[model samples]
Target: MPIVYRLRQGKKMATNDRVWCICVADYKLFAFFTDCGLMWLDTKHNIWRVVSGDMPRKLYGGAMVEYYGKLAVFWRERISNQKQEKIRCAVIALARVGEEEVRGTIEWSGVVATIPYVCGFLHCLVASD
Candidate 1:
């Protein structure tokens, strides 16, 4: 039988929203991506928090990987001005967080690269220690 994991939602989720990827930094501490944005889940307490305030653009699809103690997200960022979405990479590190919700203190975040003409859905990213 397959195992099902139900999470408490912080807000309403769209019908098309789905979890793109999940990275577990520690026990019960997981960060995941949805069509809306990046979100945090505390399995211990069964509560969810929105970590990503405003993503520059919609992430069509992608994956999240933990590398060198940092969270890296590789996805296609939709560009309204461009015909095709660009492949971008980002590094996320937690700066400040509360027990219930994620606060505004993000240690650092930035776009590492933007590969032209590359479809993010056509590839996958892997990380190793």
Candidate 2:
């Protein structure tokens, strides 16, 4: 059974960040933010920690899902070049939460693949196992 929880508006440790996606894995709450990157919130301790390593710079209208037993984040890359691009770049990135070399720390992996010309809002659904 999954335990129920709620989010109450309060002062955040970090500001100017927009939450895009959230996922629960191994009893831990993970939140993906647009400006702050990925964060691992320790519910038991009531503290939040940011995951290091390669991560998407932005996640405004992205989608996240659990695929192949791992969390996959799909989002569109913001165009920076002023060369009048026709198609936006879409990416599918994967990351797993597990033990780190420091024993109690969490490490984030890098992107898995990058595709071009993908559109629409990304969404994810987990099937009952």
Candidate 3:
């Protein structure tokens, strides 16, 4: 389910950031990747945390999905000064969260499979056996 709340003034996550993707990881928590970095809302405590773990700057937009108790954030980045770019995916484990937690940590991150050309608006789905 989706939970909605109002933003208070002078808080950390109240910046003018453009949201790229949002994923709800159960009932009480939801996370989104934005221009300012990764942020999550703790509905029970009414708190927000900026959890962009080791993510390089300048990722304008991306996609996120919940899979096997983890969040996979897929985005594209400029790989070279010649304008070469490629899609990347970051796997984040959202366990052990608390009201005072600043941000979630990225357990593992890496690039996606080789693509011949540029692309945007990434999406992910989960499967089970």
Q: Which candidate is the best by lDDT?
A: 3
Instruction: Provide the overall lDDT of each model, using Cα atoms, as 2-decimal numbers.
Output: 0.56, 0.52, 0.62
Segments of candidate 3 deviating more than 4 angstroms: 1-15, 26-28, 33-35, 52-58, 81-84, 116-118
Residue 82, candidate 2: C-alpha displacement in angstroms: 12
Q: What value does the lDDT take at residue 38 in candidate 2?
A: 70
Instruction: Supply the TM-score for candidate 1.
Output: 0.58
Considering lDDT, where higher is better, how would the candidates rank from best to worst? 3, 1, 2
TM-score of 3: 0.66
| Number of the predicted model whose TM-score against the real structure is largest | 3
Comparing 1 with 3 on TM-score, the higher-scoring candidate is 3
* Whole-structure CA lDDT of model 2: 0.52
Candidate 2 collision pairs = none
How far residue 22's Cα lies from its native spot in candidate 1, in Å, is 1.6
Candidate 1 residue-wise lDDT, 54-127, digit = tens = 44234556776665555666766666776565666666665445566553233455555465545444434555
Residue 99 in candidate 2, Cα distance off native in Å:
8.5
Model 2, 24-114: lDDT tens digits are 6544566777667777675555655676655555676666654444456655554455422132222233344454311122134344334
The C-alpha TM-scores of every prediction are: 0.58, 0.52, 0.66
